[model samples]
Target: MLETTETATDPKRARILDGALKMFLAYGFSRTTMDDIARAAEVSRPALYLLFKNKTDIYRALASVVFEESIAKARAELAGDAPLGERLFQVIDTALISVMAKIAESPHGAEILDMKGSLAGDVVEGWRAAMVGQFTAAIGEEARATGVDLAARDLSPVMLADVLFDGLEGMKMRVSGAEEQRKAVRGLVKMVELAIRP
Candidate 1:
């Protein structure tokens, strides 16, 4: 009974999110209305309203799913009983680049970049902060496992994570061109290794 219920709900929600993502990527948040999402999803506007209160709610749910999945993947990459440097590089190569590429290739990638001015809401900012926090927490755990003395280190976990995420965001643009993402990723992995060296 539970499985059937979830199976039914999951597809409908996914359908909505898929449609919204396309439209949001194309026209952006503010410009893409609920009516647009309904038409794109092939559902009635009333149905969309029943599923989501408004654009903000739908965006929050969608962003949460993406962010949570990325964080979980990073955690899994770092969970292996390997050297800290090895695990960190794996996390960067597999998890971070995966998320970055998804964003880069996504039609909504640029729209998402312009989200704040378009949505002009706190939910977006909150999600951005949450992503940073998750990254910082993961890095701190990795540093501890590696036996790095935090007090002696020049970089705080928060600062390190911030730089890492920001650096990737910048790289996503530069590397996304001419299929240079792979080369860019390699450069990033080397940069991380150099930064974490004892």
Candidate 2:
């Protein structure tokens, strides 16, 4: 079982997580031990142990922070009064591109892509489910506001959100730079606009 103690409010835990992320990105998960984290965090080994049990525990905490921050930003964008295209673009950039780019920009990018040999897979899946739920709800709200009935076209808001999310994920993988990704996202948003136009 993983430790679930609240660490977001604890400054020391946050510092530990920050240090661990940097170490993991720099040295890969296998090579980053508790001692390495302690040194990077400038915390004693005893202090680090009091906060986290092991490297995996620290990794889980770091993952939690990343997903939580990303989702919060995405939710904020969705709740904004901006036009649907701009809002949706911001959601894609926040939820998917930004998260993936963080790992890809790291020195141990390939290893991080493997997600510590599936140690973080469950965490990622949970984040994805939550994100999809949020996206679906946001889409439903927007559609109702615009009087666009997706059901008439054999589509639900959830289905549309899933399609858009998957499309963005694919596009992010294909594109390299931030500018290219933004262009791809804009193109996708345009297609979405055309698809739902009354």
Candidate 3:
């Protein structure tokens, strides 16, 4: 039996994806066309179609990659042997700061902001859920360490996590400048620290 190799093996496909991402980031889902992506990538329209089904598909692919990358970074940041409080703060601070930096550097920062309500909505929400769940689990672990019975708690981990995640997202959307973004995120980091304190 012959093994199937990856079709994306061609450098041309990678170029198309890279170019498409830039175009999508520049023009957004509603404005970008396959032709624009092909032109930017220096590939034929037919070639672009072969690589991606449509603009939505390309955006989904890019969003998935971005989401997974952010999640991995947050998880790695939380993997330290530091105290639970410090680990949680590191994860929130590092991940939010990285996300803000990416948005600030993008040419279509406003377009990127609108992506949360598009088809990529699921990707964004899914990532948020995973991040919050991780934080909640960490909190529960800390509670156990402190001899507190989480079972008798009035506040569930999910509730607490949702509040923190929503607050972080709100803060991220409100900041316009890089300095403001940094300040807003630091404030959020401090809020999370206060909230998680025993």
Candidate 4:
């Protein structure tokens, strides 16, 4: 569950976060200010302060929404009754490829998405751990169902999840475009399916 500093559903709060996202993407996080967010949001500066402590607070809130939605969508995909490889592909598409593609289309998007030196690093880390845990559980269940002897293979579900997560992150960093990413994820998913085949 997302522990956002502010509730995301409130219209005013949503407006603030959405407006902040636009400002941050347009100007980069370092250059975006509370005034800019307030102006963009159509809220008074004092009203913005009432909702968020400052620029970092808005950034963190915005990040929480993004990460929460990404994980939620990925989890929903995994919960479907698709084959293991298809499910994994859905997870990757929702969590990384689709999200990254949207961000890539925005101005200064990468700068805003950069978690380093940001107050929301913990938020990003939490999301990562959650994804790893989800993948580990899913992979363990699949292995059991398929009668794959992970012990004989010298692999554990967590280790498998770690490798998969690393590869997914690498793709996010190295893949240049949406179509390329889709192809890369397909190849990775195929490899995972082969590795786990009964």
Scored by TM-score, the top model is: 4
lDDT of 4 by residue, 4-73 (tens): 3355457789888878877877888888888999999999999999989988888877777877787887
List lDDT for all candidates, in order.
0.67, 0.79, 0.69, 0.81
Q: What TM-score, to 2 decimals, does candidate 4 have? A: 0.90
Worst 10 residues of 2 by lDDT: 1-10
Report, for all candidates in order, the number of backbone clashes: 1, 0, 0, 0
With a 3 Å backbone cut-off (N, CA, C), the pairs that clash in candidate 2 are: none
Q: Return the TM-score for candidate 3, rounded to 2 decimals.
A: 0.78
How do all models score by TM-score?
0.67, 0.88, 0.78, 0.90
RMSD of each: 4.7, 3.4, 4.9, 2.6
Model 1 spans > 4 angstroms off: 1-11, 25-33, 89-96, 106-108, 116-131, 173-175, 178-182
Q: For candidate 4, what is the lDDT? A: 0.81
Could you tell me how far off, in angstroms, the CA of residue 57 lies in candidate 3 after the best superposition? Answer: 1.1
Runs in model 4 deviating more than 4 A are 1-9
Q: Report the C-alpha displacement of residue 162, candidate 2, in angstroms.
A: 0.5
